[model samples]
Target: MALWIEAESVERRSNATEDDLQAIIRAVYRQVLGNAHVLDSQRLTNVESQFRNGDITVRNFVRAVAQSDLYRSRCFETSSPYRFIELNFKHLLGRAPQDQAEIAEHVQIYHQYGYEAEINSYIDSDEYIRSFGEHLVPSARGNRTQSGIKNVSFNRSFTLMRGFAANDVGKSAKLISDIGGNLPTKIVAPSGASGVYSNTGKRFRVAVSQVSYGPRVTQSVTTFEVGYSQLSQKIQNIQKTGGKILRVTEVA
Candidate 1:
């Protein structure tokens, strides 16, 4: 529910102490790329140095991580341009886009300006500065005012560490585009739970184990089955925001 810097992490990221600044940088790497250990040490250090020197804002620091070859090979290569754009929103802007209009807008940016420029566009936006300054991180806040299924708030840190973006905008768009001449084909059932038949809405579980919510809270693990279609939609929303899908099946 907290934005980029939760009250606790904000303390460290916004402080005057050198140790705190270093911790801030570490958190940036850990949050942005999903894991700090996987980053090349030199690149991580360089990014930290850039931020410390005031040469780059927090947005720029994040963009650097997402652009790194490591991230590209792992997260972006196979991703649809929409998924790519959505991750930028989750990781750099800290929210799901307002609608399909926004997604198309970013897809245009990616196609026109290319990857680095597309990333820089989000970080350099006025919204970025308004929501979080040079010292904070991006985390999903949900489109709570929107009608239908979009009005959901995500646990911020939980989204940042997600594995990969899974939104199907690109696939959906392709499906729509190709719907005309060739007869629309039936969606082949997935072998297990991958692709369109991917585990969607029928499953919902909150990460009560993460301390990102701070010590003031108490929670027991909870689980629910949302059914495939509904869970699928929610999962797509989660994917758009750089979140992970952790399956917690209930025991009899």
Candidate 2:
């Protein structure tokens, strides 16, 4: 399976030409918009003009694109909260959420601070600065090794990325069940076939850190082994009962 799409990094040069500026603009749209083709009507004319005139750096241009109404309409408004945040990590940070904490953090930011703040959290992050700096555009980094990232995130990134040919308009959060339950993401081939990634016949162990029984709150941890078909319902039940999920692992 091809885990990563190979693309040359497009960076801004000190003495940039007309062609250079165009390429940078295209790269910005391609990376920030999840490979979606930008229509002339959909283009952020003012932001593009600012970038063309060297008024804003690539980082700011990316910020502008992410926070644009077009992006909000396509990615945020139409997508579930989880799917929106997943795309943010893929498009801006060039990776998937490391764990549930990362996902919860972004979720909290979006709920408490608003959309622009959620986008800014990633663009202003140290990880973003270290990864792409100010001139280079953000792209999928699952192909390369990243410091402090877990091995499972590589598979999760591919799950979100799909490919360079694919756009970010997907509605469902692919890794939501796995990440929310702390399961390792399986890498499936992009052919959309049922194979190793299918959990049809698997069994999983769900660990809940806390669960409320009746009107009483119990802090004791509980574990439940369930089949794949029952996993979703079980997780839902856990959540409904005010349970904190610690992990969900496949049991052999």
Candidate 3:
């Protein structure tokens, strides 16, 4: 007779704290804007004075800031906060908010929780606020800044354990028959061993070494090689082997 039992349980983790979200937002702003303090004091004062002198209005100041290097660097061209309030809301929520009311509500929530104060401090810092008023409007085209480029190429390799089988045959013929027939079966590596080269112009190759196998059997060295045309193929090879691909190591 045999007995068996089964059970299952589920657990949920806490969501990210508001502070964590705000920190990420601040980092993104910094990466885009560069150091805001670099803006010249004289330039900011001139812009401010222009507004006071009725040479340019407050709306012009906003427009000037919006088109300046500070804004272009901090704001994404398509999905930045300046383009849409919803995008800013999404940065905070980890997803886009549904409507203007939702955007306003979350912004308020962040403010109530003191997250906005931290955000305001970053925005008001010499690095951010001053950058806004430093430069004048260009005549024809928008200023472009360099971003999101990678230089080095790297490769990833992987191996998988497909499956295994074992047979034990004692001296007794009847015992062997009871277990299974003959034992000299072929052993195959787990399906799919794969590798990848991200960034063009680099080739990737995979070499598989048989780690260890057989009962009480020493003196074993097994090796094989397979090249992949695409990353998906590499993943497939590893999956077939029931083995994991190793981290990509760069080779130039």
The candidate that achieves the highest lDDT relative to the unseen native structure: 2
Best by TM-score: 2
Which tens-of-lDDT digit does each residue in 91-113 have in candidate 3? 22112222223334544554575
C-alpha lDDT of residue 159 in model 1 = 31
Local lDDT at 26 for model 3: 34
User: Per-residue lDDT for 1-252 in model 1, tens only?
Assistant: 212333223423434577767666776665555443553554667777877877887767777877877667545785555456555666676554544456667767878888777777887888777667666766444423323324322322123222233332222122211111112223333354442333332333422121224556543443344443343344345446544334433222
Model 3, C-alpha of 181: deviation from truth (Å): 58
Give per-model CA RMSD.
16.4, 4.2, 26.4
Hey, what RMSD does candidate 3 come out at? 26.4
Model 2 per-residue lDDT tens digits across residues 1-252: 554675678899899998999999999989888888889999988989999999999999999999999889888998878779899998898888988789879989999999999999999999999999999998888767888788888888887776676677556566767887877887756455422234556788998988446787567888899886666667767876778888888798
lDDT of each: 0.50, 0.83, 0.29
Candidate 3 worst ten-residue window by lDDT: 152-161
